[model samples]
Target: MAMLDVKNTKLYISYGIVGCGNMSQAFFGRLFKDNKNKQRRVIMTYTPSNTRAHELADSIGGTSVKNLKYLNHTEVICLCFKPQQLKRFLTDAREIDFSGKTIVSILAGVDLKTLKEYFPNSPIIRLMPSMPVENGQGISLISHTDDVSKKVLDELELLSSKHSMVIKLEEKLFDKLTLVTSSGPAFVYYLFASFAKSLEEAGIRKDNSKEIIHKLFLGALSMIKNDKRDVEDLIADVCSFKGVTAAGIEELGRQNVSESILGAIDKGVERSRELQSEVRSDLPNLQ
Candidate 1:
């Protein structure tokens, strides 16, 4: 592996991403496209099947390696594989020397403790990025082990902040917040789809309804950003007393929509914990 060169006193961070899934493509694709400083680069991309690896690597102008041995050449290794695949991946790469390298994991429900058990000598950083990163609008939750160096942490922050709003969080809070930052996009999309469907049923053209709902969300978000008023105040401004919007709001409250949303989040959090337990059971030796 070639060591990082000193260029203007700044160290270049090379990443070896292990999976070529949608989330990986969304985050890394935007990062490579918008990066102008040339301080960060994708060294290699590896997957169980070489096809997706080749595709992603070609798109980013990085190498596509068929073997885990090539990962040793990279400075930071980003584990983008599914949490359930951790055991298989670790078993396959058991011989690779991850000792001085930084491991950036985006495997949901896989905690730092589990990762450290697999790669005891490596510094692990857990990152959970939302699906909106594909559009260059995302919220990423990050946490790291104590052994990670300040330089690596700063570089990761800069790299991630290019396509997402980075927030530091305690490792224990990761699963709970993953429901919000990671899974929230799908929930929002579901809500929009419901609204669009209602519009379509109310005599609007399907395409027009979808577009109107899209623009509605965009405008509402813009208002939230530009308006200084509280969210409740903004909602109040939208709803006149006993008006159409107020009627709908009253019905939603009557149906306990807020409680339903909270209940959904609770279910997701419980599933995350179940996944962690399943992973531990699968790899009992690591427990």
Candidate 2:
């Protein structure tokens, strides 16, 4: 692969990923999946173990660098490491000069303020991407500091828009959006598993139950997306007076399942805030 000329304004933005975890792999893997004939985007991946870094780099046709200093050439540095590891990572990486580069962080609880303290000269962008990006179907919520240039923002949007719906919002709303978009996939999987398990208990084969539930969800979501009627109206369509579906709906209401789901979301949002506070408390005082 040709070395990217960072000085070139027309070339695709080069990315240096500091952590090669699942999310990073999935996100970048999908990004580079269709670049067979085109110039592969320059991506420098690094991790302490170097195992995942090499794996991701190989899969994406990018380079796996040995350490942080090697990433200085890239225009964008994506911090995909764990939130709790930020302080330590910064300490170990103190020698690298990050001036003028864009710091894109996907850390769950680490906010932009803390990132600004670490990379004072670099523009920071906080992005929250859900798991579905692995399959090129995902939602990403982004918040950036005022210092970020429109060109860089446009480049990021161009890269991510192909695989995910990118929504730009204020940093203050990140935690709430994280609950719905970031943590939402797991919650949805839990519901799917619960329904599948119930089917298993009712004597359906486990594999068949899972497939059935998967298709069921896809069909329901398709209707919700395409149908003009309100969701309640669609529910009404499924539920005839004193019918089997109506009986199930009645039981769900009686059991407060809807309320329970709302409460769970509330708890998730609370936990997100608490995690943010904890990560903030761990940051050392800025010199």
Identify the leading candidate in terms of TM-score. Answer: 2
Best candidate according to lDDT: 2
**Candidate 2 residues 1-287, lDDT tens each?**
12223443354678898888989988877877655346567788899889999998888777898878888789999999888888788876776789999999999977898889879999999999988988788998899999997777777766777899888998888888888888989989998999999999999999999999999999999999999999999999999999999999999999999999888878987887787788878878776
**Model 1 regions lying over 4 Å from their true place:** 1-9, 34-42, 284-287
My TM-score estimates for the predictions, one after another, are: 0.92, 0.93
Q: Write the per-residue lDDT of candidate 1 for residues 12-100, one digit (tens) a residue.
A: 67888899888888888776654334435556889999898888787777788999988888889999988888888888887579998
Q: lDDT for every model?
A: 0.85, 0.85
Give per-candidate clash totals.
0, 0
